[model samples]
Target: MEAAISTLITEFKKYAGKDGSSSTLSKDEFQSLVSSQLSHFVKNASDPGTIDQLMGSLDENNDGELTFTEFWQLIGKVACQQGCFSQ
Candidate 1:
C-alpha cells in the first residue's frame, strides 16, 4: 500500500513537472501521461477529443490544469472500475 501510494505520487510529480508546474498537470502533460502510462486503463487514450473530455471532467475547478487531488479522482475512478475495492 505504501509503495503504491508512493508510486502514484512519484508519477504525478513526474508528469506534473513537465509543464513547469510541479503541482498541476497541464493538458499536454495529462495527455502524455494518459497515453504513456494509462493507455490500458483509459479508453481511446490516443484520441484528442477523448482526452479533452476526460480532462474537462476531471478538472473540477475549471483551471485548465489538474491538481493532485483532481488527478487522484481519476485514480479512484479507475480503481473502482477495475474492481480494486471489491470484497
Candidate 2:
C-alpha cells in the first residue's frame, strides 16, 4: 500500500512537477494522468466512463478540473480507504 501511494506521488510529480511547481493540470490532463496511473485501482480502470465518474466526484467546484488540493484530497481519501494511510 505504501508502495502504491509512493508510485502515485511519483507519477503525479512527473506530470504536475515536484510540489506542483509545474503548470496545473486541466480537466483533460487530469483525466489522462489518472487513467494511466490509477488504472489498476479505478473501477473501470482505463475506461473513459470511469475517468469521467472519478472527475465528477473529485472536481468539487464542478469546474471540470482538479487543483492540487483536490487531487491530494482524493488521493488521501483513497489511501485511507485502502488502509494505506491510517486515520
The prediction achieving the highest TM-score against the true structure is 1
Per-residue CA lDDT of model 2 for 1-87, tens digit only, reads 899778766666577643334545565677668777766555675677877887788878887667777788767776687787677
**TM-score for each candidate, following the candidate numbering:** 0.93, 0.64
Kindly list the per-residue Cα lDDT of model 1 for residues 1-87, writing each as its tens digit: 999999999999999998778999999999999999999999999899999999999999999999999999999998888986752
List ranges where model 2 is wrong by over 4 Å. 1-10, 16-22, 84-87
lDDT of each: 0.93, 0.69
For candidate 2, give the lDDT of residue 77: 72
Candidate 2: the clashing residue pairs are none
Residue 22 in model 1: lDDT? 92
- In lDDT terms, how accurate is model 1? 0.93
Candidate that would win on lDDT: 1
